[model samples]
Target: MNELISPKYQMKLAADVEKAVWDEFGSYKNVRNYIEKWYEHDEQNYNWENFRVVIRDDKNIDLNATIHSMPGEILLKVAIDLGVDTPDFIPSIPTFKNEIKSEYKTAYDTFTKAYKQIESDPSTAIGLANSALESIIKEILKDKRLKSKIKGNETLYQLSSAILKEFNFSSTEHPKEIKTIGNSLLTANQAIEKLRSEKTNFHGKTNEDFLIEDALYAHFIVNSVATVGLFLNKFYKTKYPKSEPEIEEDDILPF
Candidate 1:
């Protein structure tokens, strides 16, 4: 005697799967629509950057889920065949405006918010600078496929250097300050690093308080990093795509 009923078990499985699919689709309708649009337009053609806008700004969906909802399960199946369960899921696109990515709005928006506090509480400005640094770091790591390496308990200071190492941008290749940037970055990391621990959000704690100059410098360092990082990220991705990292090393870059 099998412990299963024909009509009941079949109905239960079908209903559960249908509900699961419905829930998944409902939660990510914008994503579904974008994916559908891609299919409707040109099944063979797609741009990761434009597609990223949809993911970063609207869907907020992870890469795998987005792949699964791809034009027709083609890319998704290829990924599965490649044994990739968790691929490099890029975060909010850097749109430079409202026409740009929305997730990044928080980081950029902080600059203005911090400016307001510069006169009264410069420490808050430093805090916002720290936040921007954090945002760009996460963005860079996500883009470079190194975010997972930075654990939850890790500090931004830790990631600052680690990101550089992971990016493989040597002193000579560094866009700015070849020799001095490393030590300077180390010191900046140390100083701003404390911002994460010390309670400097409000007006208090003389020892932890930051001055206007410090806040301004903090913004400078972070903004510089973001600018340079975005440049390097885009450059490296084009030069050393995952499919063939050695292609540039063997063919180009030597010149």
Candidate 2:
């Protein structure tokens, strides 16, 4: 179950558009308009960037397709694959303004929610982040491309670095650190599944695939949410300190 809604990919897409604009005409007035229009169009066809091309051991298999989503009509189509009801799903083509609005608000809402939650419970934040990261890594490791190359947790971090780089983060601090702080969530999930298979009342006797899928989805979601929260927290705390100990007006240039 590939979770399709990716804010990280969306951010990279916007950045790429900005760079392309800069390279073409220097700059544009707030890419919001362009972004809105792009969303209005389908995004399924959007080509993924920042992906590695891996060579299979067989040497005959070709896995050259981009792993990311696209802009315009393409992305909208991808949303359908999620089993989400859209214009294509309905004959009347129900207005999706609400859906669009919700989509737009998701990241900001997640950031705010995570921040407030973190402020009240720092331990919770760290725990949730670790749990989520572990889950995502488990799913990733299961992929044939990754499974073949990765022998242990160390190589998994290397893969995480490659993926996280697309989101503009370095693997040195949080990436590798997160990987080391805990083992793969897959192991834990598998253990739980095995216990459940034994019909252990303590394990709740739940569906294994559903449990793993839920964990994997939550893993990606929580990390992205926590990451945005942390970034915003640092930005505000550093830039707008409650106590002004230093002053340098020139440090910030006037827009």
Candidate 2, residue 210: CA error in Å? Answer: 39
RMSD in order of candidates = 21.0, 20.7
- Global Cα lDDT for candidate 2: 0.35
Tens digits of per-residue lDDT, candidate 2, 16-105, equal: 443443444332333223323333333465753323233346532122222133442233332322222233222121232222223234
* TM values, all candidates: 0.40, 0.20
TM-score of candidate 1 relative to the true fold: 0.40
Q: Write the per-residue lDDT of candidate 1 for residues 35-105, one digit (tens) a residue.
A: 44434344456633323313555535443444433332233222222222211211121222222134466
lDDT score for residue 115 of model 1 = 37
